[model samples]
Target: MTSAKSSENKQAFINGWKQSKLVRVFLYFILMLVFFLSSYQHLIVSDKNMGENTSEKEINQETPIYSEYSINSLDFLEHIFDKLEQINLDATFTYEEKTEIYKLYFLEEYNKFVEDNIKTMQQSEDSLDAAFIQEIENQLIDQQYDFPVEAFFKLPRLSQAEIIKMSAVAESIVKNLMKEQIKEADIMRGKVAEMVNASNLSDDDSRVLVTEIARFSIFPNYFYDAAATKEALSSTKTTETNYLQVVGLILLVILFVVFLYMYIKQSNLQIRNNNVQLLMLVFIFIINMMGMKIVALGHSLDYPYLGFLAPVALGSMLIAILLDYKLAFISSILFSIFASIIFNFENQMFLFDYRYGIVASVICFTSIFAVHKASQRSSILKAGILITIAACTSITAIFLITNENVISNYIFSLTFALMNGLLTAVFVIGILPFFEAAFGILSPVKLVELSNPNHPLLRKLLTETPGTYHHSVMVANLSEAAAESIGANGLLCRVGSFYHDVGKTKRPNYFIENQVNSENPHDTIDPDLSKSIIISHARDGVEMLKEYKMPKAICDIAEQHHGTTLLKYFYFKAKKQQELTGELEEEVKESDFRYPGPKAQFKEAAIVGLCDCVEAAVRSLSNPKMDQINTMVDKIIKDRLEDQQLNECDLTLKEIDTIAKSLKETLLGIFHSRIEYPELPSRDKKGVTKDEATVSI
Candidate 1:
C-alpha cells in the first residue's frame, strides 16, 4: 500500500509538471537554445580573415635578412668581373692604369661583400652561415695580386710555347683567386672564365686558357627566406571578432522567439497545454539541422547541394501526421531558414543561400501537402515520392537557371534527392509509432488499423455474435457519414462503432442481434432480470476494452453509446407484470433500467451513439421507406438531444441537423425499395401450358 501510494503520487507530480506553465516556458527556452547552438559553429566561428595586415612595408620588413647573403655573394663577384672585362687594354690606356682600376674594383667588391654579409648576420637571428663568412673574410684578406698582365703582354711577342706557358701561369693565378671566395664549383668556373678572358694575350693563347668565358653571365635567384615564409603564413591567420556574430545571433534568437510565440498562439489549446508535441517538433527540427550540420562539414564533396540528402521533409511529414499541416508548414519554413544558414559554406552569416533553402522548403512543403490527408501507412511513401520529385525538380531548375554544371550536379543531386525520399519513408515508418505512443496520439493510420475487421475483438464479434457484427458495421457506415458531415473525426466514429457492441459476444444468445437460433433467452426471464442483462453489455464492453488495452476514447464510446436512457421495453413489461401481482403502487425507478453512462463527452462518441440507435431502429423495420428512414434518424437524434446525451459534447444544432440529413440519405440508400419481380413459369404435372401457371407481372 505504501509503494502504491508513492507510485500514484509520483504520477500525479509528473502530470503536474507536464501541465505547468513555467515548465512550458522553460522548455521553449531550451528549444531556442538548441536552435542557436545547432548553427553556431557554421554561422559564427568560421574563418573571416578580417584582422590581416597586408601592407607592403610590413611584408618587406619581416622578410628574412639572410636572403641578403645570397644577393651579396653573386652580385659582388659579377661586379668585379664586369669592371675587369670592361678595361680598354687595346686602347691608349697603359697597363698600370688598368691594373689600378682592377685593384680598386676588387677592393670595392670585397668590402661590399663583407659589409652585406655582416649586416645580414646581424639582422638574422640564428640562421647565418658563420663558417662560410669567416672563410670569405680570410680569403679576401690573404689574397695578393702582382699585375701579371704587363709581364704577360711584354712576353706575348715571343713564341707560341712562351705565350702558352705565360697564359697557363696567369690562368693558374686567377683560378687560385677565384677558388678562395666561391665555394660552389659552378660559380667558381664562371669567375675563372671571366678572369682568363680579361687577360692581355693573343687569341690562340686565350683560347688555350683553361677557363672559357661564356656569352652570358649567371646571377642567383632570390634565396628562400624561412623566417619570412613562416611570418607570412602566420599573418594569414586572423583573430576573429565576435561582436558582429554575437549581434547577429541575438537578432536571430529574437526572430525565432517571436516566430515560436506566434506559432504557439495560433496552435490549438491541446498543443499549447501539452509539451510533448512541442518538444517533438523542436526535436525533429534539431535532428534535421544537426544532420545538415554533419553533412555540411564534408565540404570536400564536388556537388555543393549533395547535403540536400538530409531528411528535411521528415519533420514536415511527422508534424503533418502527428499534428496538423499548418504547424508542419510553419516548421518547414523555419527549417528552411536554418538549412540556409548551415549550408552557407562561404560563411556569409546574415546572408542566406536560397539555392539549398528554396529546394528544402519546396520539398518539405510538397511532402506536407501530399501527406495532409494521409490515412494509411502507405500514404507516407506517397508523400516521400512527392518530396523526392520536388527536391530533384527544384534543385535541377536552380542549377539550370544559375548556369551550373548540370550533368555533374544532377548526377549527385538526383541520387541524394531520391535517397532523401526513401530514407524519409524509412525513418517515418520507424519513428512514427514512438511518437504516437509517447504523445498518446491516435493518428489516422492507427485508426485505420484498428478499424480492420481482423482485429481480435472484432473477429470474435464476427464469429461469436455475427448479428451484432453486422449491426456494428451498419452503425460504422452511418456514423462515418454523419461524423464527416458534422466535421467530427469520421474514422474515429467508424472504429469506435465497430467495438461498441463487442461485449455482446460473451452472451450471444442473450442479445436479440445474435439470437439466430430462433430462441429468445429473455422470454423466460423476469423483466427486471432481462433489463439487467441488456444494460450490462455497455459496462461489459468498457471492461473488455480496458482488458484489451484499447485506447480510452474507444472505451468511452463503448461505455457511453447508450447513455442513461430509460429501457422502456423492459420497464413497461415489469410494470404490467407488477399490476397483475397487485403491486401496482410500488414505484419502479427509471435509473435501474437505464445503461450506466457518463454521457458522450465528445462529438465523435455522440455521433456514434446516435448512429448506433438509428441503424438498429432502421434494421428492425420490415420495409424501411424514405419517410420512415428520415423520421427514424430524426427521432433518434431528437430523443438523444432531449435526454441530454449531447449536452457535454461541442455539437451545435446546425451540425446535428447536418448529421440527421447524412444519416437519412445513407439509410435510404441502404434500404431503398426494389422492383417487384414476375413469377417464373412452372409446369403442371401434365406438362400443360406454362403461361397459364405463371403469375401475372
Candidate 2:
C-alpha cells in the first residue's frame, strides 16, 4: 500500500510539473542561458586569443629580418654600381677625374649615413655603450678613404688577371670598412649576433658588404628582443581585456532581454500564452546559434566571409511558415546580430561585423517576405531561389562599395552567399517536419497537405458518406471566404471544415444529408435515441481525429462545431411525441439534446462552426435566392450569438458581421440562377419542351 501511494504521488507530481507555466518559463530561461554560453564559447573562448596567458610559443621563427636585409642590400648594390658605371663611361672626364668625383660622392653618402644613424640612435631608447659610439665614430673616420679608388678607376683598362687582382684588393678594403661599422653599431642581435662574431668572413667580403648595406637601407628599424617579442605575442593572444569582456557580456544580456520584452509587447502575449510557440522560438534560436558555431569553425580558412554561408534564412523560413510573419521578422533581426558576432571572432577589435550582419539581415528579411505566405513545398524552393539572388546582389554591392578585395575574392564571397540560400532551403525542408510534429504546429503547408482529397479520413468520408463530403466542401468554401473577409486563418478554416464531419461516415444513413432515397432513420427511432446519435457524431469525430493524430485546432473544430447548442429538431420532436402521449408531467430538458462541447476556442474553429450552419441551412432551401441566402446567414449567426456559442473566441461583432456578409455572397455565387434558352427541335421531329429536348447544334 505504501508503494502504491508513492507511485500515485510521483505520477501526480509529474502531471503538475507538466502543466506548470512557471516551470516552462524557467526551462525557456535555461535555454536562453545555454544559447548565451554557447555563443560566448564559439565567438570568444574558441578563438584561443581572447584571454590572458603569459606563456606562449615565440613567433620569431620567420621574423622577416633576413629577407628584409637581403632585398634592401641587393637594391643598394645595384644603385651604387649603376652610378659608378655611368661615371666610368663618361666621355667628358678622364679616369683620374672620374675617380676623384666618385670618391667625393661616396664620402658624401657615408657622411649622411653617419649623421642619420647617430641621430636615430640618440633618439631611440635602446641602451648603447658609450665605447660602441666612440668606436663607430672612429670607424667612420677610417672608412672615409678606405675604398681602393685607383684600382677601381683602372678596372676598365686593366687585363683580366690584373682586373681580378685589383677587384680582390678593392673587395678587401670594403669588407674591412663594413666589419668595422657592423661591430661598432650593434647591427646584429640574437642568433645573427653570435653567427657573425664567430664566423671567419676574411675571404667572404660579399656577406659583410650586404650586411652593411642592409644596415643603411631605408627600412624601419627592427631589432631582435626575445623578451619583448614574447610579451607582444602573449598580449596578442588576448582579444579584449577582462573588464571589456565583462562589459560586453552585460550589454549582450541587456540587448537580449530588451528584444524578448519587445517581442512579447508586440505580440501582446500571444507567444507567452502559447507554450508551443515559445518553445518553437527557442528551438529555432538554438538551431541558429548552432549554425553560427559551425560557421565560426571555418575561421581558420583564408576566406573571412565564409561565416556568411551559415544559412541564416533557415530559421526565418521556418518561423514564417510555422509561426507568423511578425515573429519571423523579429527573429531575423536577432539572428543577424548573432551572425555578426560569430563572424567577428578573428577581428578582435570590433565587437560586431556590420558588413556581414547587414548582408545576413537583408537576406533573412527578404526570405521571410518571400516565404511568408508559402502554402506548398515548391514555394519554399522558390523562396530559396529568390533569397539567393538577393544575397548575391547584396554581397556584390558591399564588395563594390568597400573595394576591400580583388575581383576573385568578391566572386568567392558571392558564391558563398548563393550557397547560403541553397543550404537554407535544404535545411528548412529537412527540419520543418520535425519542428511541426514536435510543436504540433499546423503550418499552412501541412494544412494544404491535409486538405488533399486522397487523405484516408477524407477518402472514407467521400466513399461512404458522399453527401457529407459535398456538404463539407461547400462549408469549406463558405468558411474560407468568411475567414478571409475578417483577416483570419482562411486556409485553416477550409482545411478544418473538410475534416469536421468525418464521423458521419460511421452511421451515414442516420444523418439527413446521407439519407438518400427519401429514407429517414430518425423517423423509426425514439427522439431521445435520435438525439443521442446526432450528438454522438461530434464526440466520435473528436475521437477519430485524435486517432489520426490530427492537429488540436482541427480536432477542436470537429468537437465544437455544434458547440453545446440544443438539437431543436430532435428536442421539438421529443416534446411533440410526449404531448401526443399526454405525458405532460415529465419535464423536457434542453441540455439532454445539446452536444458535449467546450465551445469554440479560436477564430478559425468559430468561423468553421458558423459556416457549417450557414452551408447546411442554405443547402436545405428549395431555391436559395439572394434574399433567402442573406436572411439565412444572418439568422444562423444571430442564433449562434444568442446561444453564446462564440463567447469564448476572440471574434468581434464587426468581424462576425463581415463573416455573415462573406458567406452570403459565396452562397449566392454557388447557387446562382441559370439563363433561359429558346425552344429546340428534338430527334423525333416533333416540338418538345426546352428542358426535355436534346439539340445537336
RMSD (Å) of each candidate, 1 decimal: 18.2, 13.5
Cα error of candidate 2 at position 624, Å: 2.7
Best by TM-score: 2
lDDT of 1 by residue, 139-178 (tens): 3344322223433343223344544444454545443443
**After TM-score superposition, what is the CA distance of residue 96 in candidate 2 from its true location, in Å?**
35
Clash totals for all models, in order? 0, 0
Alpha-carbon runs more than 4 Å astray in model 1? 1-34, 45-306, 406-410, 546-549, 582-587, 674-697
Give the TM-scores of the predictions, in the order they appear. 0.64, 0.67
> Which run of 10 residues does model 1 get worst, by summed lDDT?
49-58
User: Model 2, 363-397: lDDT tens per residue?
Assistant: 89988888888888988888889888988888888
